[model samples]
Target: MSADKTILIAGTYDTKDDELSYLADCIRGQGGGVLTMDVSVLGDPKAPTDVSKHDVAQVGGSSIEAAIDSGDENVAMQIMAKGAAAMAAQLHSEGKIDGAIVLGGTMGTDLALDLCSALPLGVPKFVVSTVSFSAMLPPERLAADIQMILWAGGLYGLNSVCKSSLSQAAGAVLGAARAVEPPKRDRPLIGMTSFGKTILHYMVKLKPALEQRGYEVAVFHATGMGGRAFESLAEQGAFACVMDFATQEVGNHMMGSGISAGADRMTNAGLKGIPQMVAPACYDLVDLIGWQPLPDRLQGREAHAHNRLLTSVLLSTEERREVARLMADKLSTATGPTTFLLPNQGGNEWDRPGAPLHDAEGLAAFCSEMRAACPANVTLEDLDCHINDDAFSEQVLAIFDQWVAEGIVPEGVS
Candidate 1:
């Protein structure tokens, strides 16, 4: 941190006053500046804050006098959270801070969540929470790319445990802000989705092909959390075009699997009107469990474990067709040029001939339903090759080239 980047320190200062002050001094010791925002509900902070509780509460449509006089703890915290987010966001926009760190037990964690999400991507958002990376905190609740560390033994005071977590978190934020260089936006970026390389190898072919055409490429794996990040960034208009080749998260969500990426899995890029081509990659099997023992509830359909955390279970023809209809329904609302690529031979690795999960009838049922349900405003292409086939990659590149030539995609320099 030779440039001395400013790090925003936000928390319930009344409860964690000594902790927050120690953190500020630690960061300042590392040659980084600090901006403090107090989000305490009832009491006053021992440390001075750039944004005071009175100002923050007023900004969040509440008065400190009212909050202190009469209110529920949760309601007061909510008001403070809103105010902290507003003040933090304004500071960030004015370039007063390069990154932010928020510390909390539970209420503080909830308050920090809002402040973290309020800041945009590329700002180092970190949370030192007692519930760091807990299953209770869903990926959607945190901003994309937020880093979290467990606040071990940090419930009450400044012990060795608190010092260790705070010290590491302070260093982590500075390291992130200093090391990250802005992206080279010389070319239009194309986002491509994939799963295991064995299943969605077209990612490899698509990347170089798009780069050859003077476009940049970003690939997102189709895991549950990965899907959320991809969708969130797309909503921010990060990509000029998207090759949505691996869409299993949608089916996973429909099946109520833990591998779900929420209900809007396959709709973000379409809603943003970015030129996009979608394929049925990895839609063959719903992810169940990995190397772990299969729960009795997940019995049937030729389950196979891919790795420690990925188990695939086959979907019947009717189930596959139903997902296809749902997907087409979502695509029908696209506001920009969209293409649904139907790879007639197969969709996922398990759908090929002689594979344990292969179901020709299921694939055919999906194709029929998809083609019939596709909107007339959207384009549909039926290809004879499998999703991972070389021909599929070729077709995607060709479509991208045509989109660029027609000015549907802005021409990007290498």
Candidate 2:
């Protein structure tokens, strides 16, 4: 590990020269190197940068000439954003920079998002923005696994309030780059989805069983953003295989809930043909708007408040079948090997003969629809045990083991 780190300071130097310069000095005081990349769209930067706006805008596949001549701030920013991302990526590839930190209001954050995304995962990326925690921006727009800091009073210039936030961000990025080890993945990475342990506890046992067989298990929550990130990384071939057990987001989206990973959630892993095992875990619970009264359509449905922000509504027999159909249509197009598993007794922990969520009719509905829509390349498996049962995990592992032996599963670095 190197004692010193190189930090990329990416921001609009035309208007934020003082704040950016202060941040660079703070990083240097802590024994780190700085490479400032200017992303200004309107005027030339007040100070010199290692990489100018012209250098970055050209990289974005658009010319700064078009931006200045058009007199459209949007057009210029778009071009500069691309250029900044291109320049930063090139520097990182050449070992000129290790991590990045950016300070911006809104447009700055927008450009910063692309720059951070261009740098691969495991590199510490941080952004200081006024809207760091705003809910108006969908989590899907948060393109990278980038950390965000609330930029208090960092609007136009450097002040006491602004300096305090900028200084901390500078120190934080430097310390992280020096101390944080790259996220290591030496085993076959498995991407699994889950909700709560109570709803899907098989993961607790299944994780170790897979690790024991020399594979890494990476679990993604079934929340909207979690599903999106999983699919994005899947498209990038990040996982050797995936255990898509929790299908709650699928049900949530079909019902037009805000908790959707878009209509294209499960398509990536299928399109990429990564070996996958699919299950209807938590499919009985549809995410509904929370922190307020339920909609009129859900007037008589059984609902459970997952938290202050989100609630879960029990689906009817027909709705369960609809979800199954949606999933089948999506999974049927998979170019890679796939196994769709069904638990005849229950799909989740509390869904059984006498439990609160048990519905034999609902389970049957899904099974029937999936069977009818399953493609020739996909296999459907039915187990007599509950989803959380030891037998269920054993069956899933047995299939995975067979896939590995047959070279259906690959070893991946991500």
- Count backbone clashes in candidate 1: 0
Model 2 vs. true fold: TM: 0.91
lDDT value, candidate 2, whole model: 0.83
Candidate 1 local lDDT, 322-389, one digit each (tens): 88888888898789899999999998777789988788888888889888888876799999999889
lDDT of 2 by residue, 1-414 (tens): 333789999888888898999999999888899988988877777767898888887778877788899787777787888888888889999999989998888888888878887787778899999989665555555553678899999887779998899999998999989888875767778999887786788899889888877788888888887887787677778889989998788888889888877677787898998999999888888887687678788888777776898888889888888888888888978999999998877777667778776777877887788788777788999888888899989999899989888888863333
Question: Cα miss at 169, model 2 (Å)?
Answer: 1.6
lDDT of 1 at 277: 96
Off by over 4 Å in 2: 1-3, 288-292, 411-414
Enumerate clash totals for all models, in the order shown. Answer: 0, 2
lDDT per model vs. reference: 0.84, 0.83
Query: Which run of 10 residues does model 2 get worst, by summed lDDT?
Result: 135-144
TM-score against truth, every candidate = 0.93, 0.91
In model 2, residue pairs whose N, Cα or C atoms come closer than 3 Å (at least 3 residues apart or on different chains), thus clashing, are 56-83, 273-336
In candidate 2 the C-alpha lDDT for residue 87 amounts to 85
